[model samples]
Target: MRRREFLKGCASLSACSLLFPSFVFAYSGQPLKRYKRAHLVWEDGRPVKAKEIKPEEEYLFFYPFRATPCLLVNTQQKLKGAKLRLEDGKEYIWKGGIGPGRSIVAFVAICTHQLSYPTRERTLISYHPPGKKSSLLERDRVIQCCAHMSAFDPAKGGKVIEGPAKDPLPAVILSEENGKIYAEAVLGRDLFEEFFDVYRRELRKEYGSSKKAKEEVNRCVTTPLRKYTKEVIRC
Candidate 1:
């Protein structure tokens, strides 16, 4: 089936549909968290200007919580608004990208399949820009998790297009002002609890404690994924 048709069919299926068993179901309601507004800044603390972001580059930043990472991208093309559906069949409209050219977007970096995320040592998941070959059969731009081969369409609110992941990556809603971008909130099912549970030992070793790891942030530094991690393991 064509990609568009497959996505449409997936979206229209009921919770009781055959595809339900394959979905990694999360809590029912769409959870929305309005975090303390955090400015996306550089290491020197200068605000990250939206217009200066290079197209198709993957930037990483931590927000809402100190331990949780998010991916920022500029696809360089105006994106269509996408209707995103959660595993339990809940739906919400992602209002396309923000900033100049309406091409900038961001999402929580943790994979819904198993919560695998980018770490300082290595990243199991990362953005594969258009024309970039990935282990996944699809060659289009996607946020891919090599751990399980789940691929998410960055242009479509991080919708899962392949592999086992069922929920769209939770979006980090952004707002731009005075040419700078800020993360305002996260919209989608709550996955932080599960992520924390699975990574508690690592989080404690890096953050001192799980509580500290979850602390709200007022400033976030944006760095290129290469600068953010020591290695990128592409499958």
Candidate 2:
């Protein structure tokens, strides 16, 4: 009876280990600092008069309409809004919020899973591969990547929930000057590129050499061996 009980306990533990393998190598979430807006177009490819926008209205920019960059002014008092883009020489529609009063939220238009751009369909876009759903609605509440069905909370700065996404979508910053709102920056900080450098050092201390032990041995032995052979031939 004692042996049977021990075997059952081991089986249960093994099952639990297989069920939660994700916890073994979870990704960390660290906050990046917010940055000011830069590189925005207003009228005729000119800098936006940021302070000119009013609280109750949302300004829109349409790219490549005729002469490349066109400004579409919509002062709708509702929360829903639309903007068109031609970034990377491709056409994409961005659907999000006009907010209650001068509030703005922005997210990357690409699907995090496969980079398939989702088109707006009454605030929701559905994916075909495995059939998933995501959306952007009313004041940047959430930007959903439909390919993997990952929902990101923009107010919380693009944190991910549900689906297969392990990283948040890159965020765009906004600023106002002369009552007009303009995009400031993407992901707030340029330091995001250095994330891997910080993580690799931490991993080395905790998990040992990320480089193979065999590779390190091969490098050290080959260099000394070649030098010793040269010395012997000279003698």
Candidate 3:
């Protein structure tokens, strides 16, 4: 190619890079965009206590079980991990332990695979020691999704064991308070909540339809991706 042509192309690419550096790296080695997370307060108008959470306790009002800020009171002692969601829209790498006589070790509740929300509704298989089989029983550790069979050690910063997931779940900063477990700085709680509300309504409307419930559901699912592009890309 001519030198003039090459110079012009370089100039054009440089300008474009300056404009959307985040998108450029999104495909290669640039890290995923990390946003600031605000602290999550409990329904009682107090900061989340970081003490051992009991089983059957609700952390986030939306989901139940050991997912995201949900309480899991166990009777074992050792380092453990679980999938948890912070109030923020981002996931975390949570790890902790249940003192031998202690009650439980809790963390965020998000699947390591594409951030799919895993629940106690099903069993999730995970790899704890980086490449070992770790069955995520609803009653034991975090409910790892069996979709791709990803394992995570809650005590070890929710590390991925054997699966396609590359990054560990984000960890919510935690602290103990007055004998209660308090979670701190959930990545994307409020935004997800808001988005979830609108998304839920649309899904309900679509599902409530009898003739094309499946079609409606598919549309409802993809609708957010469209909306997200509109808001982020300003299209």
Q: Worst lDDT window (10 residues) for model 2?
A: 216-225
Candidate 3 lDDT over 82-141, as tens digits, reads 454332334543335333533343334455454444233322322122222233433344
Error of 1 at 227 (Å): 0.9
Off by over 4 Å in 1: 1-31
Residue 223 of candidate 1: its Cα lDDT? Answer: 93
Q: Which stretches of candidate 2 lie over 4 Å from their true place?
A: 1-102, 119-140, 188-235
Alpha-carbon error at 7 in model 2, in Å?
68
* Per-prediction CA RMSD (Å): 11.1, 23.9, 15.4
Best by lDDT: 1
TM-score of each: 0.84, 0.34, 0.39
What lDDT is obtained when candidate 1 is compared to the true structure?
0.82
Score candidate 2 by lDDT.
0.33
Better-scoring candidate (lDDT), 1 or 3: 1
- All candidates in order of TM-score, best leading: 1, 3, 2
lDDT of 2 by residue, 185-221 (tens): 3442222223324444543453464342112110001
